[model samples]
Target: MTSSTPLPPEGHGLPQEIIDTIIDTVSDSTTLKACTLVRHDWLPRARQNLFCELSFPPATLRGEERWRSDYEEVLRSVVMDVAHSNIKPPLSAAVRRLKLHFTDTSSELGFLEITSQLPFKNLHAIELLDSDLYRFEDHDQDALFLFLRENPSLKELRLDGVNSEPKKFLHFFSRLAGLQLQLRSLYLNDFFGYHDDYHEPESTFLHSLPLLSNPPALQTLALHDVSRTEADIFVIPLLTTPSRFFDLSCLQSLEFKFPFIESDEAILKMCGATVMRFTIKGIAHRIHDGVILEKCFHHLSNLVRLELHSVHPDRHGIVLLLLEHVPILRRLGQLSMQFVKAPSRVRDSSPPYTSAEWALFGEGVDSKVDQLMQTSNPSLKHITLDIPCSWKNVTEERIREYFPKTNSKAVLEVFRIQDS
Candidate 1:
């Protein structure tokens, strides 16, 4: 009776596994910030969410910082402390993917220079969009190289919306050829914005080889808005056969997104055994004519994903379409599609035979599925469709209505391409 009441039983916290599951589900930044602040244990998970996709807002920092007059401004410390080594490891170490998006000729080029040089050992992927930082005349380019050299862990590199000439573009290949690590995925889109409109009489860059004496390690190589002739004559030959030297056998997924498909199907066939994913997006008249696929695809018995999508935005919109890059697949997967040449205009977009357009799209889709049956039996299945029309005639709703139902043919519920 004199004994004090037994102390209330201690309550153990949730199991660590369960706590991680809870943290993983909450994806929003604001909530993640709150979760990190709540306790130190949760900080690791929260920081992972926050820093994993460290994307700089593209438009917000587009223009230059206005000049300030007072000495007080100097003391304010305008230098970004983001990538500094002094920053907390919990934040810096957690970063896995970094996407730095900017506009053309932006004034804050210095910001990009400083932020990119920071050391983050765990960084696995980097995407630089819409910035011409590759200009060798600038220090920022050197800084970018330094950052790349430091991050040996990088698995993927995507350079999209970069506008430069062929000679400047070749420099990128030359540098990448020197990297020690094998990249799982490399996507180059409009790197020059070099269009048929300019139509240079001679693409001298193709005739010349990259400075690399050896091939760069690559699993997935996607070329967008690049010239068809150059890809066949220069890039492919130099990379694959290399003029009586070693073959670039590292390629697994190879894609081309030029305005037209020329007689390069043989190059694709040469890599057929190793190339799991094959994609081509553009007018695709060659594919529609049936010669390209007939000649190229039958050889790729191990091919997993085959995506042929329209590239013209007015008639079609494919954002990295057809190439659903599974960086680690190096992760095998399956896919297929046929090609169709449809005019961008149909009697001034009055929805003329909305069914016909759907019919044509369906035919292309169904044929691809059939063609891949032998090759991609064990590959990952993904159908990415680029929505090129901005509702000029048919709405997104209208497009969805005619999609094929592939449920009976395979495990796939739909035979059609799904918008991502």
Candidate 2:
């Protein structure tokens, strides 16, 4: 019998770069853990990939309370390991993003406090989902403020389904000012801050912030499903007037959802001159007749890219109206339109379009495409249509048949999206 071939030296087989690329593409946690045992040089990259994003209760749990306790225990164990282990280039330094959930439970609040004490040196992004900021005690608030103050590298913050009183909200922003943290992007969705009747005091306090005189520059902002009253009291002043919270002149991208209101028009006018990309969502069929819609597009003079999402049935006229306003956008280059199915509750209320309606809609869009191409100094280049998978066949066939000129130019693209 022959002797077994001797093993190659550690880290001697694959080049380091190639091994790093392979580890980067491994999405399964089990496989990534196995990679850590391969060799010493491979440990750093594998650990970085494994800890880059830490989600409490893991997003996969998705509010299943039964699995939450077990998941939390696992998270605590991992954090303890990182804190006590002697691994080189400690796991704490690899964490770049954190997704945390805040609830009313005492145990959950304690978890948040524990998370704030961790040493995350390179963290840059934080997302808080379904948070109840009003319920936070003084200690809880201090923990969050301390966390933000410690992470100077943080640049993005997102709050979804967050509920707070106007005073508490202002205090949150005030704390951010005290830290002098410069954020690049901010997103607020379904954020509730009481009713419109309280606008006076809220507005007064918001304008009185000392930092309002020298607000930091922000690059991107998004507001979705926020009530008009909340916008008037909280958001409009931050964008329309000079505030130490955000400098609208420096904003480059904006995403706004519909039911166009007066406050939104004011924001567009202030930020439109510099905004290069804009996205409008929740467009209903009834909004095509709104005068506010016409005025809003007029201010986007410098817009280069536009996206229209969740367009309702028989609302094709809105697309035509939008393009008419685009002649002013000499820099316009790309346009994307997304069509989605109505929600289950409203599906019965809004029926799907028949073949006749689709034919008429296609013809109207085809004509608009031709008109846009004929404009002088036409910068238009690409157009994308995203249709739900259920309507993929019918919508794609009709679009191809009617958009002959667009097809000939080879600038049109179609994609199928999941129904949900």
RMSD of each: 9.0, 6.1
TM-score of 2: 0.80
In model 2, where do residues sit more than 4 Å from their true spots? Answer: 1-43, 66-82, 85-89, 106-112, 195-204, 212-214, 341-363, 395-398
Which pairs, if any, clash in model 1?
316-388, 317-386, 317-387, 317-388, 328-331, 333-379, 333-380, 334-379, 334-380, 406-415
**Tens digits of lDDT, candidate 1, 192-258:** 4343443444335444544445544567777777556445433454455433222446578788764
TM-score of 1: 0.62
The whole-model C-alpha lDDT of candidate 1 against the native structure comes to 0.53
Q: Model 2's lDDT to the true fold? A: 0.71
Task: Give the TM-scores of the predictions, in the order they appear.
Answer: 0.62, 0.80
- lDDT, residue 25, model 1: 85
On residues 1-420, what C-alpha lDDT tens digit does candidate 2 reach at each position?
432443347524765556778888994388878767866567778878777887776767757775555645655676687688776667678888888765446345366577776767678888888887767677878887788778888888889988877666766766665564477888898888854345456557766776655665778888998877787777775566455466778789999887678877888888878888999888764554357776777788878898888876555666677667667677788888787763333212222344533523543655675566556328888778777766633566666655676667888887878875
What clash count goes with each model?
10, 2
